[model samples]
Target: MRISTITNWAYGVTVGLTLLSGGAFILSARSADHERQAVVESQALDELSERLTMAAEQTSEDARLFVMRGEDRHLQAFRGDENGERDREQALKSFKAAALLQQEMALIQEIEQDGEALDAIEERAVTAYTNGDQEGARQTLFGAEHERVQSDLLTSVRQLTDLIATRTNDALTDAKQWSDFWGAVAKSLLGLTAAVFLGVLYFVLRRRVAMPLMRMTGIVNRLARQDYAVEVLTDNRRDEIGEMNDAIQIFRDNGLERERLDAERRADQRTKDLILQMMHRLQACQRQEELAEVVSLFAPQIFPDFAGHLYVMNDSRTALSSIGSWREPRRAGPVLTSAECWALRRGRPHVSDAAAGDIPCQHLEHADEMGICVPLSAQGDTVGLLYFEGASDSQAIASARLYFELIAENIGLGVANLQLRDRLMGLAIRDGLTGLLNRRSLDDALNRIARDEQGDVIAMMVDIDHFKRFNDEFGHDAGDEVMRRVSAILSETVGEAGTVYRFGGEEFAILLEGGAEGSALDLAEKLRTLIAATPVTYHGRLLGAVTISLGAASTTADMPSADVLLRADAALLSAKAKGRNRAVADWVERSSTDRRRA
Candidate 1:
């Protein structure tokens, strides 16, 4: 039952019991009062009967005295002793008016008649004595008839006294017994009320209210301390405590849910922090190797269950090769061609797991393991790949596919940025027309030679001989074509032996650093002969035989970059002054070798 209902019922029953007990006590008190009143009334009736007997006897005594002594004082005393209108008659009248029992009233009536008969005899004797008939009044006062009348009256008075005493005693005993019965009933009722109170205390308070409350107190305290692990017992009772137990259970459930969410939030924040750190390092990397190293270091921390590789697409964009790897991946190879992986072909993320019924990458040797390939793309162009394999659970990898793709994106951008920077650097230092190192790069090479003491460098300056004749004859396009062919010949003959630069328009410069056994004129003569020997063809027209004059200079010791170039230029002017199709050397100084003009 509900606690409210139980408590209400207890209250009502207790009140009713208490009221009944109080009523019983009230009845008991009234019974005691009635008993005392009965005792008092019985005593008053007994005292009235005694007084009437005394008054009648005294009237007879006073009449005898008046008849025997013939004294007027006796006669007066007879009247005073209640012979006429006395307290004796008044007692009779009061007894007749009282609420007496029928037998007691009969006794009182007998006393009244005996007193009246005695009063009449006594009055006749007194009246005779007062009229001078002494002998007759004396005889009447002492006569047997008078004695019989007086004796009978005294007997009736004594009987009335005995009757009053007997009736009073009976009344007192009956009143006491009745009072005692009611008092015992009151005491028993009070005892029953006490038992009811004690039963309620033991059963209702201790079992129903107190014990459950005690258990709930501990549960509540644990809940207050945020200990959701504490068990709250379910109570099926339809009481306040039962409702409280349910509420506590609910609070514990909510607390557990909150804890779970907080844990996930913390884990998510950790993932974000790792990603942030990886991205920052990526942004700072100057090379693809550095970017790969950054990815290798942080990717495992983000997803520990998987192992992966960082691949960089080769410059031709035809294939991707692993630059770095981490966590000992078992399936994918170190190199993957563009066609070997679907992610590279499609430029998107692809999961490769034959167990999951997905197409596997060709580079994966064993397709039993799950793998995810996120194409590292920037500006819609795939630069590289991030391949993770060895995950047993495909769902695990797929769930975090977004994070993997994000990592791939940043690394791809880094790789693309490095490639772009290298391209830009190449454009800055390379010649646009002949595709040879420009003047700026040649100057830098000479500066390095100047910095290196005890270094020998040979400077050869070659120019196309009458290169403007073709531009004037067949147009500048043919001239441009001739220059391009001559530049290619110079580069091809020099190969790895020296440095070639397009010094200016229709002019070429070469630096030969490694020791050449033949004098510098031989290499210069070979270059001039080759240019003259090769046929030049452009737009279906042969631009005759293209020839070149050469000026060559060699440094024996410390390289003076400016002085050597000036000597080579002066020698070239000398060769032009000598006649066009020939090679010349600086004549002021000579290495102890044969300087033959070719």
Candidate 2:
């Protein structure tokens, strides 16, 4: 039951017990009053009986004295006693009225009759004595009839006194018994009320209310400290404590929810931190390989359960090829056409799983594998792809999507920047007219090749014969076309064997690593023959028979890179001095002469 109901019941019961106790006390008080009244009535009856006896005796004595002495005083005394009989009669009437029992009333009646008879005899005797018949008075006062009446009155008085005494004693005993019984009842009622009050206090206040409150206090304390693990009891009760327990349970549930949100917040912050770190490393990457390495290293830490690959579009913008991959449980091929990937075709991120009804990407090895493809784009151009796989569940994939997109965005920008830098570097080092390494790059290449001591290095210098005459005959434009065609021929003839550089307006240089003097002479002669046979066409005009003079030099153990280019230039001048459209080697002529002389 409710606590208020229990308290009200206890209060009501206590009030009822108090009222009963009060009633018992009132009854006991009434019984005590009746006992006192009984004592007073008993004393009154005894006094009346004694007064009746004295009146009878006094009349007898007074009548006898008047008869014997015959004096006036004696006569007056006799008359006084005779006249007081009326007072005695009144006392008998009072006693009869006050009597409680029939037997007591009957005794009062007998006493009244006896007193009246005695008074009649005395009165007759007193009249005779007054008329000078003393004998008659004496006989009346002391006669057998008078004496019998007086004796009867005295006996009746004695019986009445004894009966009053016995009745008063019985009344006193009964009154005492009644008072005692009610007093015991009052005491018992009071005792019973006290026991009930104590029981209510112990059971309701201490056991039911206080004990549960104490337990709830502990539970609330734990909940205050954010401990949601504590158990909440007392929910089954129908009391105030049960209501409090329910409230505590709600608090615990909220605390648990708050804890879950806090954990997610921390995890999200950690993931963001990892993403920021990965972005910093990406920005620091100097090459595509370095960027790939950074992505490979950070991707696993960012999404540990996911396996992914980084793909960069080829230079032709026709396809994408994998540059790096990490934690790939199911590997795909290294290359894929741009048309094969939905993300590339759609220019957005695409997701596929078992339940996804869309067609899978052609690059994926397993058609049923769950994955997401985030196209890496920057400035509206899709530069690469960031593909992820091995999402264990839908929740995991959903959680990873944001981070994956973040990674793709940063990596795309990074790769774009790298590609731009490479293009700028190429533009800076390449010759615009002939697409060969310019003079500045040629100097750098010569230094690098000469620094390597592995094998002989060859340098060749070629000059177009009468190149100024062609420009003077046709035009500067045609002359420019002639130079372009010659550069192309040099590049094609020296393919994979050496590097070509446009040294000046009409002069070209070649550096071949790991080549001997004899091979250099052979290569120089081939270049001379090809240039003499090939014709240049410009704007539908064919310029015929363009030839060149070539000089070749090979590195000795002690030859410096600067001397190698100087000797080749000297040999080219000698070739021009002998005749145009010819090839010469700086060391081959001396070697031929020594062999002939030996």
Candidate 3:
């Protein structure tokens, strides 16, 4: 029940009991009042009876005195007694008005008749004594008839007094019984009221209100400290305590919700911080491989459930090759053609799952596996592809799409930067006219070759025969065309066996690794013959028959790279002195013996 209802019930019961007790007290008071009135009336009746007996005795004595003495004082005393008899008569009349019983009234009437007879006898005696009949008066005053009448009168008064005492004592007993009964009832009611009040105080205040309030105080304190794990007790009563419990339950639920949101917020902030750190590292990456390593290191930390690969477009822009991968991703191949990826073709991210109806990327090894392909592009050019797989659930992959795109964007820019830097470096070390490694690249290559003390290194120097004459005969542009054709021949002959450099102005150099000195001289002679065989076509004009002089040097155990180049140039000068279109070697005797055997 509601607290208010309980309190009202307690109050009502207390009031009712109090009223009952009060009514009982009122009844007891009335009983005591009746008992007091009965006692007063009984006393009055006894006093009146005693006075009547005295009056009768006084009248008899006064009459005898007058008869004996005949003095006027005795006569006056007799008259005074006669006058006092009226008071006795009035007392008897008062008794008649008191609702007396029939037996008691008859007794009182008999007494009244006897007193009148006695008084008449005294009056006659008094008259005779005054009229000179002393003997007669004396006899009448002390006569047997007067004595008998007086005796009857006194006897009747005594009987009336005993009757009044008996009646009054019975009335007092009845009044006392009523007063005691009502007093017991009042006491019982008062005791019941007190017991009921104590019960209400204990049950309602102590058990219902105080105990529950104490328990709720502890719960509220824990909630204030943000301890949401604490359990809330439920109450089903429709009372104030129940209402407070419900409010606390609501507060606990809100605290749990706030805790969950706070955890998510902190996780999201940490992810953002990781992304920011990754971007900063990406900016400092000097090579595509370094950038790949950075991504590989941080990707798992960012999304541990996902396995991914970083792919960069090849120089031909036709295929993407994996530069870095993490978590041993499935279905991402080492190489994929540009046309095989939808992300690359469409320039956006493509996601595929087991339930998705869309076509999957051709680059994926498994057709049914879930995956996402995010194209990495920078400044309107697609630079690479980022492929991811192995998300535990679709929602996880969906939530991770944004981070994937962010990683792809940064990787693309980094790869693009690395590619641009490589292209610029290439231009810096390449010959503009001949499309071969320039002098600076040759020096660097020769230095590297000199450091390798275990390998046999060969250096060949070649020059066109009469190159300045051709430039003076035809135009310089035709001369330029001839030199370009000869450089192409030298490069094609060397292939992967060595590097060819344009030393300067129709002078070229070739550096080979792991070739004998005789083999080097033979290779130089073959290059001199091919330059004479092939003619140059410049703007549809054929410049005929460009021959070249060649000189070659091979490294011994301790030959420096610079000394080898100088010896090869000296041999070229010796070939020019002997004849313009022949080959010479620093070990010329070994070359001749090997040539004779061929």
Predicted model with the maximum lDDT: 3
After aligning candidate 1 to the native by TM-score, how far in Å is the CA of 524 from where it should be? 20
- What would the TM-score be for candidate 3 when compared with the true structure? 0.64
Per-residue lDDT over 1-598 for candidate 2, one digit per residue giving the tens place of the 0 to 100 score:
8888898998999999889989988888888988998888877877777777776787777778878887788777766655555557767877867855778778777887887788789889988988889898888889999989988888888887888889888988898788888888889889989998998889988988888889888988988888778988646878777777788888888899899999989988988999999999999998999999999999998888888889999989999889999996474577888998889999988886656677788777777778789999999989999988887587878888988888899999999999998878878888888888988898888777667655678889999999998899889999989999999999999999999999998999999888767777888889999888887888888877799999888778666566788888888998999987998887875578789999
lDDT of 1 by residue, 3-81 (tens): 7888788788888878888887888788789889988888788778877877777778778877877777877887776
Candidate 1 ranges beyond 4 A from true positions:
1-36, 52-78, 81-83, 86-88, 113-277, 300-308, 313-322, 325-373, 379-383, 387-401, 419-598
Ranking by TM-score: 2, 3, 1
Off by over 4 Å in 3: 1-200, 236-243, 315-319, 331-342, 355-370, 390-399, 429-439, 447-558, 568-598
After superposing candidate 2 on the true structure, give the runs of residues whose Cα lies further than 4 Å from its correct spot.
1-9, 12-16, 32-107, 110-200, 223-231, 234-247, 250-254, 316-318, 329-335, 356-362, 365-369, 390-396, 430-440, 448-557, 565-598
Of the pair 1 and 2, which is ahead by lDDT?
A: 2
Task: Tell me the lDDT of model 1 at 206.
Answer: 92
Scored by CA lDDT, what does every candidate get? 0.82, 0.85, 0.86
Could you estimate the TM-score for every candidate? 0.55, 0.65, 0.64
* Steric overlap count per candidate: 0, 0, 0
Cα deviation at 191, candidate 2, in Å, is: 4.4
Clashing pairs in 3: none
Task: Please estimate how well model 1 matches the true structure, expressed as its whole-model Cα lDDT.
Answer: 0.82
